[model samples]
Target: MITIQNLDKAFAKQKVLSDVTIKIADGEKVLLLGHNGAGKTTLIRCLLGEYRPDHGTVTVAGHSLAHERVAALRKIAFVPQLPPPIRFTLNELFEYAAKIGHCDIDKIRKNSIYFGLNTDAHDHKAFYKLSGGMKQKTLISIAFSRDADIFIFDEPTANLDTMGRDRFRERISADAMKEKTIIFIGHRLEELSSVVTRIIELDLGKVIRDEQA
Candidate 1:
C-alpha cells in the first residue's frame, strides 16, 4: 500500500501541492487524472522520492520514503511520461537496468518483442537515437520486466501507434496483471477504462475527486 498524509510541496515558494492526502491499497488499479500544472507530475515525483515533501509523509508498502528512499523505491516500477536522455546503447541499457534493478534481461527482451519492438536490431544503437515510440516501448518493457509491488505509468502510450497502443492496453489489462497495484496518468481515460478500478482527479494542486469507477 502507498500512503500520503498532509502532503505539501512548493517550488521557489510557489505552492504546487497542498495538504494532499491519499491512500492506495494493494491490487488497486488507479487512474490519476489532471491537466497541466495541476500537480500530477509533482505528486508522482514526490511518491517516487525524486522530490522530498516539505511537510507530511509518504509511505510505500510500509516503508517510509523519507527514511528509506532506496528501499521504498525498490518496491515500485515506473515508466515516465518521457524517456530520459540516456547516452547508453540498447544493449548497455539493458545490462545496466538488469544489474541495478535485479531483473532478468531475457524477460525485458521478451516483453519488448511482445510489444513489437525489435531490440535485437537496435541493440547497438544509442537509446536517444531511437524514435519516440521505440523508446516508449523499451521503457514499458523494462518496467513490466521488473518485479515490483507497484507499477506507475505516466502517459505511457503517448508515443505509441494505434496497434502499439492496443497492444499496451491488452498487456496491462491481462488477467495476470489484475492483482497488481497500478497507477496510470493519461489523458485518454477510455483506453484504460476496462482495467481501472478507481479514478482520482487532481486539480489546482489538490484532489478534487476520488471514487470507484
Candidate 2:
C-alpha cells in the first residue's frame, strides 16, 4: 500500500502542493488527472522519493520514502512524460537497467515487437536519436519489464500511434495488473477506464475529486 499524509511542497516562492492526503491500496490502478501546473508531477515525484515533501510522510509498502528512499524506490518502476536525453544505445540501455533492478531485457524486446518498434533494426542506435514514438516505446517497455510492485506512468501515450496505443492497452490488461499498484498520470480519459480502478483529479495544488472508476 501507498500512503501520503499531510503532503505539502513548495518551490522557491511558489506553493505547488497543498496538504494532500491520500491512500492507495495494492493492485489499485489510479488515474491522476490534472492540467499543467496542477501539482501532478510534484505528487508523483514525492511518491518516487525524488522530491522531499515539506510537511508530510509518504510510505510505500510500509517503507517511508524519507527514511528509506532506496528501498521504497526499488519497488517502483516509473516512466516520465518526456524521455531523458540519454545517449546510450538500445543494448546499453538494457544493460544499465539490468544492473539497477530485476530488468527483463528479453521481455522489453518482446514488448518492443508488440508495439511494432522493431528494436532489432536499431539496436545500435543512440536512444536520443530515436523518434518520439520509438523513445516512448522503449521507455514503456523497459519500465513494464522490470520486477516492481508499483508502476508509475506519466502521460505514457503522448507520442504513440494508433497501433502502438492499442498494443499498449492490450499489454496493461487485467491479467498484467494482478498484483502491482499503478499510478497513471494522464490528461484524457479514453481507453484507460478499463484498467483504472480509481480517478483522482487535482486542481491548482489540491485534490478536487477522487472516485471509483
Candidate 3:
C-alpha cells in the first residue's frame, strides 16, 4: 500500500500541492488525470522520493519514505514522460539496473520486442543517441524488468506509434500485472479506461475528482 497524508509542497513561494491525501491499495490500477500545471508531476516526484513533502508523509509498503528512502523506492518501478538523457549504452544501463534492483535482462529484451524495439539491434548504442520512440521503449522495458510492487507511468505512450500504443494498453491489462499497483498519468481517458480501475483528477494542486472506473 501507498499513502500520502496531508501532503503539502511548494516551490519558491508557489504552492504546487496542498493538503493532498491519498491512499492506494495493492492491485489498484489508477489513472491520474490532470491538465498541465495541475501538480500531477509534483505529486509523482514526491512518490518517487525525488522531492520531500514539506508538511506530510509518504509511505510505501509500510516503509516511510523520509526514514527509509531506499527501501520505499525499491518497491516501485517508474517510467517518466520524458526519458532521461543517459550516456550509457543499453548493455551498460541494463548492467547497472541489475546491480541496484532485481532486474531481469531477458525480460527487458522481451518487453522491448513487445514494443517493436529490437534490443539486439541497439544494445551498443548510447541511450541519449536513440530516437524519442526508441528511448521511451527502452525506459518502459527497463521499468517492466524490475519485479516491483508498484508501477508508475507518466505519459508513457507519448512517443509510441499507434500500434505501439495499443500494445502498451494490452500489456497493462495482461494477467501478469493483475496483482501489482499501477498508477498511470495520462490524458487519453478512452485509451486507458479499459485497463484502469479508478480515476483520480487533480486541479489547481488539489484533487477535484476521484472515482471508480
Best by TM-score: 1
Q: Tell me the tens digit of each residue's lDDT in model 3 across 68-120.
A: 98889987999988888999998898788777767777787788898888778
| Tens digit of per-residue lDDT, candidate 1, span 111-148 | 88989899878999999999999999999989988888
**Against the hidden reference, what TM-scores do the models get?**
0.97, 0.96, 0.96
Ranking by lDDT: 1, 3, 2
lDDT of 2: 0.89
Residues 139-161 of candidate 2 have per-residue lDDT tens digits of: 88888788888999999898999
lDDT of 3: 0.89
lDDT (C-alpha, whole model) for all candidates: 0.91, 0.89, 0.89
Q: Which whole-number lDDT from 0 to 100 does residue 9 have in model 1? A: 96
| Order of models, best TM-score first | 1, 3, 2
Pick out the ten consecutive residues of candidate 2 with the lowest summed lDDT. Answer: 97-106
TM-score of 2: 0.96
